[model samples]
Target: MRKILAALLLALFASTAAQAKWYEASSEHFVIYADDSEEDILRFAENLERYHSAMSLVTGRAIETPSPSNRVVIFVAGGKGDMRELTGSRWVGGFYVARAGASRAFVQTIRNKSGYPHFSTVILLHEYAHHFLISSARHSMPRWLGEGAAEFFAASSFDSEGGMQLGMPARHRANEISYAGIPPVEYLLDPKAFVESDREASGSFYGASWALFHMLIFDDARKGQLTSYWRLLNEGTDSLEAGKQAFGDLEQLDKDLKKYLKQKRMSLFRIGPDQLTTRPVTLRELPKGEAKMMDVRIVSQHGVTREEALDLVEEARKIAAKYPDDAGVQVALAEAEFDAGFNEAAIAAADRAIALDPSRPNAYVQKGYAQFSIAEEAEDKDAAYATAMETFSALNRLENDHPVPLIHYYRSFVERGAEPSETARHALERASQLAPFDKALAMNAAMMQAGEGKIALALVGLSPVANNPHGGELADTARLYVAQLEKAEEGTPWQPEEGEAKATGNEAKDPVAEGAAKKPTGS
Candidate 1:
C-alpha cells in the first residue's frame, strides 16, 4: 500500500510539472522577472507594457521578443557593467539589456531612477518593436522615425479624481524647436541628419517628428492621402515618388510644411525660456485666498524634471507652512513630490492634502498614481496586479484622449498573462489617437493587429515611419507582416483595421451614445 501511494504521489507531481511547462510554452512571451519582490515585478511589467505599446505605435506593427525564452527575465542590476549585458543597448538616458531568446531583461534601476517608469516603458517598447519586426513583420523601419516616435510617447499619464494631465511632459518639448530656434522642416525630415544626431538632439528629433507628423495627418488634404503614401512605399517607391503619389510634387509638400511652421512659430506656447524669463510679472507679492493658492499650484504643476519639480514642491510646502490648512498648497506639494519620484514624500503630502480637503481631485489622482507605483514596485504578484487594475479603472473614468493611462492599463492586463484581444487593441488604438503623431502608439497598435492575424492592417499602419531612423524598425516589421499575410493560410479571418476614434468624448460629438443608438451604415 505504501509503495503504491508513493508512486501515485510521484505521478501527480510529474503531471503538475508538465502542466506548468505547458502553460509557459503556450505563449511566445517570456515572463520578465526584474527582482525577487512583487513590487519590482509589477513595476517592471508596467514599464514593459508602455514600452511595447510605444514600439508598436512607432513602427506600425507588432513587436515580439523571445528570451529571458518565451518569457522576458528582468534582473535588478548593481552597476553599469551588468546593465551593458542586459541592454546590448546604447540609449542615452537609461540602462537595460535585451537579447533574443534570453527571456530576461537586466535593467539598472538604481543609478538614475527618476524616470524609471517612463524609461522602462520606452525601452521595452523599443526592443519589443524590434522583436515583432524581425519575427512577425520581417521588415525594417528607419531608426530616426522609430526612436523619435518612441520618445514622443515615453511621457505617460494616469487618472485622478481631480483631472487628467501629463505624466512627464517633456520639459524641453516646446523648447526643442523654439519657433525660430529649431532646424528647418527639411532638416527635421532629413533621414541622414536624423540618424547622425547625438542623444541631446534626440528630443529635438522627436519634437520635430511629432510636429511634422501631426501636420501631415491633421491637415485636411494630407489626411486623405495617408493610405496612398503607405501603398506607394510598400510597392518600393522612393520617398520622393511616394510623396508625389500621395501628395503631389516634393516642392508642394515643402511649401505646405513651411507655411504651417510659420503659423506655429509665432504662437505664445512656442516661445523659448529666454522670452519667458524676460516676460513681465503681474503680481509683486503673493495674493490672498484662491488666487495665491492657484498661483502656487500652477508653479508646482508645471516643472518637468525631478530637481525642477522639487523646487516647486519646496515652495508649495513653504506657503502651506504659512497657511497650514490650505488644501491647494498641500495638493500642489503632493503633485510635485510624486512627479519628482519621492513616492513616500508624495504620499505624505497627499495625505495632508486630502485631510485638508477630501473633495479635491488632485489629491485622489496623486494618491492613485502613488498607489499604482507602489503596486508596480511591490514583491507580491497578486497585490501588484490588483493595485494596478484598481488604479486603471479609477483613472479610465477621468482620462479623455490621454494616451498615457491607456498604456499603463494595457500593460497591467498584459502582465497578468492576458492575450492581446479586443480590449487590448482598443486601449492601444485610443493611445495612438490621443497622440496621433506618436510613432510608438501606432507601432503598438500595428503589432497587436499582426498578433491577431491582421498583417495587412499592420503594414498599413506602419507605413508612416518607413523613411526615418526612429521608425525604421517598424518599417522592417510591417514588411515582414505583409509578406506573411500573402502566404498565410486561407482560413484565417481577414484582419480588420483597429478601432477608430468614432467613440469619442473630447475629440468628437456624443460618440458613446451615438455609437450605441445608431445602426451601421453600408459602405
Candidate 2:
C-alpha cells in the first residue's frame, strides 16, 4: 500500500510538471519569460525596447545593451495567483530584483486595480528606469526624486501607431496628493523623512514627491532647476541646501508647486516613431522540460531564506540530473548550490556548465565567483586568485562591455597586496564608469584612487555614496573613508590599514576577494 501511494505521488508530480511550458522572447536589452501566447510575448518585448529608447532620449543617457549573460530577465506570470506562487508575495503585483550578478523583473499579466492599462508594462518600466539610471550615473538621487521620476516615467502611454507619450501625470498619485496633504518642501527634501516614514506618511511622501517632480519637469520657470539640483546633490551638497540653491526662494517654489498641482491639465512629453526603435521583436518557445527548469532556476536564484534555498537546491539537482548535458541546467544547479552556501559544489557544477558550453558567459562568472569564495577562506590564496583572474580574463574577451570581469580583474591585484598596474587601473576605472552607481565598483575605484595618492578625487568619489540616507554598511564604509580623507586633508597623515576598508554592502563584503558578486538595483 505504501509503494502504491508513493508511485501515485510520483505520477502526480510528473503530470504537474508537464503543464509548465514557457515561451521566451528577446530584444536588444531584455529577455522575457512568459506562459502567454507568442504574439503577446513578442509585443511585450517590442514595447520594452521602445520604452528603453524613450528613456534614453529623455535622460540623454546612452543605452548600453547588457550582454546575453547579463540581460535583464522578465518573468510574466499568467495571473495574480501564479505571481504569488512564484514570488511569495500576494500584495506585490510586480517587482524587480538584482542579485548574483543578474537583474530580473517578476510580474503578472493583470489589470491594474487603479484603472490603469498595461499595468505590467508600467511596473516593468518603472523598475527599468531605476536600473537604467543607476547604470548610467555615479550617484543615487534622494528617494523622493528617484520615486517621483519612476512614477512620472511609468505614467507613459504608447499608441498603436507607434507614437509614445512620456511625463504624463500619474492620476492615482495625483489623487493621493489630494487625499494626503503635501508635506513641507523642506521636510520632503530630508532623506530621513523619505526613508523612515510610516506607511501612511509614505503615501503622502510619494504623492508630494510626484507633484513636486511634475512641476519641476514641466513648469516653465522651474524646468531648468531639476538638472541643477541633481548636480548639486551629486556633488555631496545637503539636500535642503541643494534645493534652495537650485530653486531660489523656498516659499515661492512651494507656491509654484501648489499651483502647478492644482491645474486641471498638465503637459506631457511626446516622441515620434522616428525617435524610437522600430525593430520587430523576436521570440522562441522553449521545450516544456526546459521551461520548467527555467522557472525553477528563477525561483532558486531569488530565494531569500535558508530553507527556501535548500529546497530550491534539491529541486535544481533533480532537474540537473534529468538534463545532465544541458549547460543551462548545470548553471542553474551552480547558482542554487551557491545560494545554499555549498561553495565547492557550486564550483563543480559551474565547471560542468562550462564544459558543456564554453561559450556561455554566466557559467564563467559563477565559476570565478565560487573560486573567489573558496580563496577567501583557503590558506593558499595566491593559486586561487590566479585561477579566478584567468577565468575573468576569458570572460572579458568574450564580453568586453561586462563590468564584472573588469571589477574582478582589478580586485585580484588588490587582494594580492599589489598596487594596481596601469592595465588594472584602467579596467577598474572603466568598470566604475560603466556601473557608476554600483557601490562595490565605486568603492573599489575610490580606494584605488586613494592608493595612488589622489586623495581629493577619492573623497569626491565617495561623497555621493556617503550622503545616502538609507544608511547601510556600505554607507557606513563610505562615511569612514570620508572621515579618513578629511583627516588626511588636515595633515593628520591618515591611511587605511591593510584590509581595513573592506567592501561592506550586499554586493561586496571582502573587498578584493569578493569582487562584484551581486548588483542590487535599489528599487
Candidate 3:
C-alpha cells in the first residue's frame, strides 16, 4: 500500500523538534514507481535496510532506515543539472527523509551516471546510510561524521556475480581535492568547521570520512576500539572525544585512510542490462522460487495481442478499480501504464494514487513523466511545445534539487526553439556539473553547443561518452558533426549531418559554399 506524506506539515512539524518528525515537508508527498529495467530503487532500498539492520545490530542502537511506507519515486534521467542540487540539497542522491504530522516521506533517485549501475548503486547506498543514521540517532548527528559514515557504507558493494567488494571514495569529492585543496584533519573533526570551509574544493572530506571510518572499523589495531567509539558517539560523545577514542592517533589514521582510498581496487562489476531491473518486488520474488514472475510478466506482455503492453496496463487498472483504496493496486496500474507508453493514462492513474494518499512522490514523478512523454509526442509547433514546457515547469517547482526535472526541461527547450537555446545550454551545463559522467546529458549539451557554433567545445563534451552502448549513436552523430565542422573550417564544405545536428543556425561561416557543396553531393 502507498501513503503520501504532506510536505507542509512535515516542515512545520520538523521545526518544532528534529527528532519528532523524520521526513519534513508535508506539501511534497508523492509515490515513486521504480523503473523495471536497468534500475531498481526497491533493491537499493532493501540493501539499505540490510545495512541499517546490520549496523543497528552491531552498534546496539535503533538505526532507522528511511520510511518504507511512504510513496517513493524511482526513475532515471539523462544526468544533467546543477551539481549543488545533488550535494547542497542534503537529500538528493540519497534516501531523503521528509515528514508531515505523523506521516513520513522517502525518495531514491539513482541513475546511470558513471556508465555502470553498480557505481550508481553505491551512490544510492550512501543516501540510505544517511537515512539509517538519522533514524537510529533520532537526533541531528554531526555532519562530517554523519556524512563520513554514510560514505563509508556507500563505499561497500555486493553483487551476485562478483560477490562483495568495496567501492572507491566519491569521485566528485576526489576531483574537487585534486583540482583544489584539502583541509586539515583537525578542521574536519569539527562539524561546523568542516561545514564552514568549501570542502568541495579539496575533495578531502569524502576521503577523510572514508578513512576515519575504515580505520575505526577495519584497521587492525583500532578495530578493537570500534565498539567503544561507536557506543560513545551513540551516547553523544563530543567530537574531539570521539576522535580521541576512535583513533588514538587520529591524524595518522586519517592519512592511512586517504592512502587506502587512493589505492583501493574496484573490480568494475559490469552488470549487463539484464541484471539492472528497477522492480524490487520482482527481484525479491526471485529468491522465493518465483524468479520468473517478472519474466512471466514480460513474456505475458510480449505474447499478447497488438500493443499488449497497453492492454496489460488496462488490465492492471481494472484490477485496481476493484479495490478503490488500494494504493498498491493504483501504483501497479500506473506502472503498467508507464511501461506501456500510455503517458496520459499513466499520469491519470498516478494522480488517482495521490488522491488516495497524497504523501507519495511517486505519483508526482509519474505525472511529470507522463506529461513529458506527451510533450515529446506533441505535434504542434506552439501547442505541443507549450505542453512540454508546462510539464517541466511543474516538475521543477515540486523539487528544485532534482536533476531529472531539469534535464527534461532543458531538452524541451532545445526541442521547441532556439530562442531559449542559451538558457537550455546553461541548464545542461549545470546538469553536467552535477553528474559529469552521464553520457546522454553530456551529448545533448554538446549538441546544444554545436548548435550555437561551438563545435570544438561540443566535441569535448561528446568525447566522454564515445564508447558506451547508449552513447554510441550520439557519439557517431557528434563525430560526424565534428568532421563537418572541420571540413567547413578548411573551406571544403560537405553535406550537413542529419537530424538535430543539421539544425545549424545563422552562424554558418559560409552558407553559400556549404549549400553549393551539398548540392553536388545530392547528385
RMSD for each model, in Å, please?
21.2, 5.8, 20.0
Q: TM per model? A: 0.39, 0.83, 0.39
Best lDDT goes to which candidate? 2
Specify the poorest-scoring 10-residue window by lDDT in model 2: 508-517
Best candidate according to TM-score: 2
Q: Note the Cα lDDT for every prediction shown.
A: 0.44, 0.69, 0.45
Best to worst by lDDT, what's the order? 2, 3, 1
| Candidate 3 residue lDDT tens string, 112-176 | 23222444455555654554554444233454566667666666544543223333345544654
* Model 2 TM-score relative to the real fold: 0.83
**Backbone clashes, each candidate:** 83, 0, 44
Backbone clashes counted, model 2 = 0
lDDT of 2 by residue, 103-155 (tens): 66777662322224465666777767767776766566776787678778888
Residue 348 CA displacement from its true place in model 3, Å: 15
**Deviating ranges (above 4 Å) for candidate 2:** 1-18, 82-88, 99-101, 110-120, 138-140, 192-202, 231-237, 278-280, 377-379, 414-422, 467-471, 483-487, 490-503, 507-523
